[model samples]
Target: MPLIDKIAWLHLHDGRILSTRSRGKDAYYLPGGKREPGETDADTLLREIREELTVTLDPASLQLRGVFTAPAHGHAPDVLVQMTLYAATYTGQLQPAAEIEEIVWLSYRHRPQVSAVDQLIFDWLRELGELAE
Candidate 1:
């Protein structure tokens, strides 16, 4: 199977999680992207977040939450995506930037709107009572 390694930012609010969709995408994804060479997950994530969401994540407040993998959305059947997820506090407002076209707070009820891996994350969060909405 082909593998795509990426990082994700998990920002929660009132039992919901923040999700974003790019200009031409159909499914919302956790706000983050793949790591560039010579960059750590923190480095890649911070830059991606700022570029996509216009927010600066607090390095001191960043914490690894979990890693998840599933069939890569919008890719071939044998392709998979492995996501390293981090929870962090940020400065500045969350707004669409770059290719981002929409930002929404997602609950378990909205699981179908996200990608396969994101649905798994929602399931895990719901079990922990963090995404009960």
Candidate 2:
């Protein structure tokens, strides 16, 4: 099985997590992207967040939340996505940038509107009493 390795930021505020929808995409996703060549997890997180949300993540404040794996959305059934989740502090206002079309705060109730991996994340967050219904 092929695996899509990606990093994601878990920015929860008021019991809702920040999520993004890219232009022409139907499902929302967490605000990070794949690791570039020679880039560390922190590097990927910072770069992706800045590109998608226009915020500079505070490197010293990055915290490993968890790693999650699920079927890769919109891909072949045999493909999987491995998401490395992080919680961090950031600077600047969060605005949709680059390919991002919308930014929203999603609670557990919004699970159905997100990607498959994000649904797993919602379950995990809900179980931990971190995500609101």
Candidate 3:
């Protein structure tokens, strides 16, 4: 199976994580996307978040949380996504832009509303007791 390499920002606030739903999309995803050629995870995350959420991430605060792999949502059955997750501090107000349709704060209870890979993230957060509703 082919793997879609991606990076994601894990912004947690008051036990909830930030999520984004793009225009016409049914599932929410962590606020980040595919890495451009030769881009580092931090590079991809900073760029994607700026494009989708109109915020600039603080590079000094970037931390590696985890890397996860799961079947890619909305793709062929065997296609996979490998996501490098980061916890980072960002500057500027978060406003939906580019392809984002909505910005939502999600808890473990909101798992069903997210993609397969994101569901895994919710599970991880719940295991750490950081996703209480």
Candidate 4:
């Protein structure tokens, strides 16, 4: 099976997590993207967040949240996505940028609207008492 590697940010507020929907996409996803060659996790996180959400993540504030693997959304059953999640403090207003078409805060009840890996993330956060029922 092929694995698609990605980095994601976990920004939670009032029992909800930040999520985005890209242009022309159905499922919502965390506000981050795949790592480019020669980029570390921090590098990818910084770049992707700024590009997608118009915010600059404070490098020193980046914290490892968790890593999750699931069947890639909209892909072959054999394809997998490994998402490395991080929690961090950021500057500037969060807005839809780049390919992002919408921004929303989602709780556990919104699980069906997100991607496969994101559903796993919602479950994890609920288990940790961080996501709302």
Candidate 2: tens digits of C-alpha lDDT, residues 15-73:
99999999998999998999999999999999999988989999999999999999998
* Order of the predicted models by lDDT, top scorer first: 4, 2, 1, 3
TM-score of 4: 0.99
TM-score of each: 0.98, 0.98, 0.98, 0.99
Q: Give lDDT tens digits, candidate 4, residues 69-119.
A: 999999999999999999999999999999999999999999999999999
lDDT of 3 by residue, 1-133 (tens): 8999989999999999999999988999998999999998888999999999999999999999999999999999999999899999989999999999999998888999999999898999899898975
For model 1, how does the per-residue alpha-carbon lDDT over 27-117 read when each residue is reduced to its tens digit?
Answer: 9999999988899999999999999999999999989999999999999999999999999999998899999999999899999999999
Task: Kindly report which residue stretches of model 4 are placed more than 4 angstroms away from their true locations once superposed.
Answer: none
What is the alpha-carbon lDDT of model 1 when measured against the actual structure?
A: 0.95
Which structure among the candidates has the greatest lDDT? Answer: 4
Worst 10 residues of 4 by lDDT: 119-128
Backbone clashes in candidate 3 total 0
Poorest stretch of ten by lDDT in candidate 2 = 46-55
Clashes of each: 0, 0, 0, 0
RMSD of 4: 0.5
